[model samples]
Target: MRTNQESKRRWRWARGVLGPFAISVLVGGSVSVSSGFRESELQCEEAYAHLEDCCGALHGAISCTYEEGCAGQTPALDVVQSKCIRKLSCSEIEALGMCDASAWRSDAGAPLCP
Candidate 1:
């Protein structure tokens, strides 16, 4: 049986050690997530450079990717979408852009975005 004084001492010691450890764990996780998001954004920007008249759709995807609940789906929807656009020829990109502004629909037949 621990006395009140001993319990308080144990609590203080645990807090002293665990407080910083918990904060470090949180901060470390935050740093990695933010860095990963930034990296993905950078890649998206790079992919966007090769595209023209498609920023609207790509920007919309970027916005969604950063949205609170939507972030879980794809940390880099813009990057993935832009990469898909990059795979198309200039005429195809132009056609897709002219067809819809937020044309971010996935192909029914394909596993990835069309």
Candidate 2:
């Protein structure tokens, strides 16, 4: 039992508050893409190189990663490492392009081509 004038005022106040919030969420949510690059590691030359190599191996996998509402398996680092060895020379991987080559090499301690 509110009067017509009071009802109009309340409606106006609710619209003024909720309208902008709803619009902002809709607009902002659309622009955000989940580029699943993990932030735990620093962005170094080696890291970028590794990312490029990994993404190259899992080109299909990367596309799968970006699919909407995708629930299937994602590519793993080991797969990328195997592909890197198969596709690129050890010297190439050892180069500065592989961001913090020392760290990656040490971590990927497996023997490469002599």
Top TM-score prediction, candidate number = 1
lDDT of 2 by residue, 1-114 (tens): 999999999999999999999999987877563334432212322334444564343222212121225574322234444444446553565452343333334345433322
TM-score of each: 0.40, 0.33
- lDDT score of residue 40 within candidate 2: 21
lDDT of 1 at 97: 56
Could you tell me how far off, in angstroms, the CA of residue 64 lies in candidate 1 after the best superposition?
A: 14
Maximum-lDDT candidate? 1
Report the C-alpha displacement of residue 40, candidate 1, in angstroms: 5.7
Pairs that collide in candidate 2 are 45-99, 46-98, 46-99, 47-99
| Tens-digit lDDT track of model 1 for 43-89 | 56555555534434344433224434743554334567657756777
Model 1 residue 94 CA deviation (Å) reads 7.5
